[model samples]
Target: MAEDAIVVDESLGSETLLDLRSLSVTYQTDQGPVPAVRGVDLTVRRGEVVGVAGESGCGKSTLASTVLRLQPATATVTGEVLVSGADVITMRWGELRALRWAGASIVFQGALHALNPVQSVGAQIGEPIRIHEPGIEDSEVTARISELLQQVGLSPSRAAMYPHQLSGGQRQRVMIAMALACRPALIVADEPTTALDVMVQAQVLGVLEKLVKDLDVGMMIISHDLSVLASSCDRIVVMYAGRVVEEGPAHAVFDRALHPYTAALSAAFPRVGDPAARFAPAGLAGDPPDPTSRPPGCSFAPRCPLAIEACREAEPELREIEPGRWAACIRVGEP
Candidate 1:
């Protein structure tokens, strides 16, 4: 599929920004090698919000960590991750550190723990600017921090408060503000609304939506909330057991999914503007195969509703089924 697509709605702008090719991350445990993120390729474009949606243990966060190279010591990462035409996986440590803030940044999960309780939010946000461009004066750094706080919808006055002083949504905005301090070209948000109250989730997601529109920054939003992904992202990549099962335009993927896993996830959500029509969320029976001992064929075959003889004997590669849609299911496009 093309990196750039024509904007269906004239109101939103579109362009290509970051791309990942065959990105895979594995870890060596006593049992054996466990693949956390297996052969997943994703893209986020300028002025576009891309959603990576999957259930818990679906490797959504692992994929995000691999994108940022935030892994444990025993982890082995292999694949191409390109940001602004530069391969992240191959960069030297010095190069990687230099690329972090200006090229891309991350709003990781567990913000309460990510932020230091001792320091103020303003100092945390100013750290990047100060470290990266030491020549910039203190006044400029302070002004930039305030602007970032305002951009993420946090009150400028709240910058002086420590993380413990703010609510969940406010803390999340602080994380986002810190990620945006250096005006990054891309942002990776992993479960940005995981533990927030329902009311707070709506408000935080609104701020994220506005960030994409106003800052023109490419975003990779990792979440299991289909409703949020459907509303916030331009495209969706559905991950299953460490692999991408389906990917396409957000609405099209949700409405007309190809893979059985994608279909099950779609069936689990309530459609917008159709609250009166209720249906049980289609649950995929059984569990995803143990990553330590995945099956010979498709990893999802054990739990798939439509598993067949071939599905149990041969793995399928992700391939484009249409001009812009890709799926890893053998049954897709078959009569």
Candidate 2:
């Protein structure tokens, strides 16, 4: 069944589990400060999965990594990253180490590389407990590790096996179990199901969805796959050239997208009921502008189908088109 996404109307509660305000990230290259993400805002409520979809190099991964402060020193980041009311950027090394896993956890894109290949899966999952819950006994830790493995649909006994001993899907399951080990209030999964077989991806997504429900944890599921986000998230934010182009409830965004970029992205994806029908993705023509050399006015103006001279000279704010739906394009109400 396709889950209808929730639209945020003016009356909708502003209470957020994770809040990102006017966030921007700039990389210091030989060319100078290169902005990867600009003036982006996102809010994920408790127990909801918010999907961030964008093309490669469109800052989806950078945005997710910023929430964890995982980027390198060269990246100049300015913004308020509030998780449960504490600003993540201001936290010191000790505070950050303590806050992570306890406050939020991450399931990185490459589970195989994320896991310690030589270590038993059990140890990797238990590492969080050992660090954060040092007060607990070894017997208690063992019991918790077994329960976590079971929670992610892996056999409890499999924990004793090494990463190489499990299939790709099983490794991903271990990663999810590790993220949930400390019962984190929030989780950031960066293309978590990537490189898995279809059946395995479905299984892993199912486990993640179930965990979000059972644990009441907020989540940010970042990917380029439209259907995956549509099926898994409560809301969707579409990005292009490091800026938000469109955003709304997942169902509404798919059913009646308001932005040209949104329409183009949907056309690129194979429809669920008509998978056999080939979809010739309308690839966005021309390469993305160099980050250090982004054009004035609308960043996507050059690629927009309905762009005009005004679009090239005027920056468009992401505004509500209809209730919860928002688009950064100047032209609206078109097919």
Candidate 3:
């Protein structure tokens, strides 16, 4: 198993499980091409949990979907997306389909909608196993499904129930079980705990954390909730206006944010026991920029409290502000 390092060097043998180099996704719209993700360079090593956190429409989901080539036919994807050293973008259709579960799988949000309403949870969990490993025996598939359900903190019997019959948390657990059926090296969990109550969210996250660790699988968890990421992820990458603004160790990004956007995001989620944070939670003043009509220069400059004349002239590149930490603000190293 790989060591529990938040940042792993790309030079470190084959530890890099997922590598995105200058990855971008643009959707064809009636008006024009809308860029949902732009020049995103990220890597996830084995046995690491990386979190992507941002506000709605910030392209968190787009980045996640693009990794698996799950985007729509109208969307245009460019650049390299390497999963287990295989380029997903150029892979043939047959290879891509075969890679879906065995290479990487997604636990999408809204499990109620993601799962078939009429199918039993056990069947849903076993579907991927049967599809990817067609020669597996029926009895073995049934046993694997039951074992997965139990691993996710659900009773094996619960697998017989339909999606509608399960609670929100139970449905999310089923989604996790389905993702694990293939034992893929990487898992992208997009808002895995969405719509669940606070207690249930914690429970689901705990199960996810345990599974990722015990299986030594790389994981990329996308959520609008910084607190959720901070609690469960080893590192956090902050995205805004379809670009990464900052990334660092989760505790550092949550407690000592460098970029204005990341700082605002961290403050938006107040600490439970902190009296000051509860009373005066910080908030960003404006909505994200339109994808098709992104303004010149920094996309976030219009709403950035510390924006200066230089910020309006060009978009800042993501530069290392500290060792193993990156931020896209020109003022990051300023006094």
Candidate 4:
């Protein structure tokens, strides 16, 4: 019954960079406490790209925000968030500040809004370097900014432009440039491709994958798009109603998902050229349950096509039905 027992993969080895053990987050609202994430256990090894996929309100964004202690003051967090063996939840303010850009950084969605309207892109990117490595010379910081801009496929001259001057894709590149400025060991990208055109999305994603591979940085990419994750991540974790219901290698989880929720999600996003899927893409029948008033047994039972009496009566713990894949369903191995 221990929370950590639900983790699927055991061969992550010693280079595990980010470890989340029984991590939970609850917001103290006027109505009552609303749980956004619940008893989740996850691990991201060095040089690995792990994707957390779910619908908009399924707590993927909350999980990404909580990893860096960016959740609001009204939210109460539990359990551990270890970044390179250090516990972030218990770190002091000074320690957390230092950890923010140096140890780990986030590439948030909506680059147009995340960036300061008044500041130049160069100044924004330089801000992290100045804060994290205080004693570095101005010349060196400027040089680093240029390097980062180029790294993300933007011209060094683009640094002098304000956020409003750049295209959506260019602005996103600026965000990526800022994230890489500190050279953090881990990067959490929350819906990084949101609101961009298809071609632009591919470009931005390509930049992220290249940087992570080139720098050997561990990345946690959170997105509602299973196709995006399947194309970019090594492993994928599927969450429903604030809990991870299925997880495994990207190919297995996306192509042959074991959990009904995961299957529904994958089916919802069909390939562009696939005629069969394009004509009649599958969609889930109902909306996700209300997080504040989630049902007792399986949170997904009400909508699961394969749900049975057992699913409606008792929540199933995440269990490994295959060698490296796990699913939380009573009929995991059954036809």
> Each candidate: how many clashes?
0, 0, 0, 0
Residue 279 lDDT (model 2): 47
Put down candidate 4 lDDT per residue, 274-334, tens digits, no spaces: 8999888999998999987888799999898888888888889999998879999988898
Scored by lDDT, the top model is: 3
Relative to the unseen true structure, what is the C-alpha lDDT of residue 320 in candidate 3, on a scale of 0 to 100? Answer: 96
- The alpha-carbon deviation from the true structure for residue 114 of candidate 1, after best TM-score superposition, in angstroms, is 1.5
How far in Å is the alpha carbon of 8 misplaced in model 1? 8.2
Q: Candidate 3 at residue 96, lDDT?
A: 96
Question: Model 2: residues >4 Å from true position, as ranges?
Answer: 1-15, 275-281
Cα deviation at 293, candidate 3, in Å, is 1.0
TM-score of each: 0.92, 0.93, 0.96, 0.95
Q: Report the lDDT tens digits of candidate 3 across residue range 1-335.
A: 12245324344543888999999999998998999999999998888889999999999999999878989998899999999999999999999999998889999998999999999999999999999999999999999998999899999998889999999999999999999999999999999987899999999999999998799899999999999998888889999988999998888888899999999998998898999999999888989998889999999999999999999999999999998789999999898
RMSD of 4: 4.1
Tens digit per residue, CA lDDT, model 1, 55-169: 8888898888766577787888888888877887888998888888778898977789989999999999999999889799999988999899988887789979999999988
Tens digits of per-residue lDDT for model 2, 1-335 = 22422433234554577899988999998888889999899988776788898878889999998887888899988988888888888888898888788888999988889999899999999999999988889889899999999999888999889999999999999999999998889999999987798899999999999988788788999988877888888889998888898998888787677888778777677776765535454566776677888899888778788898988997788999997789998888556
> What lDDT would each prediction earn against the true structure?
0.84, 0.85, 0.91, 0.90
Model 2 TM-score is 0.93
Better of 1 and 3 by TM-score: 3
Whole-structure CA lDDT of model 1:
0.84
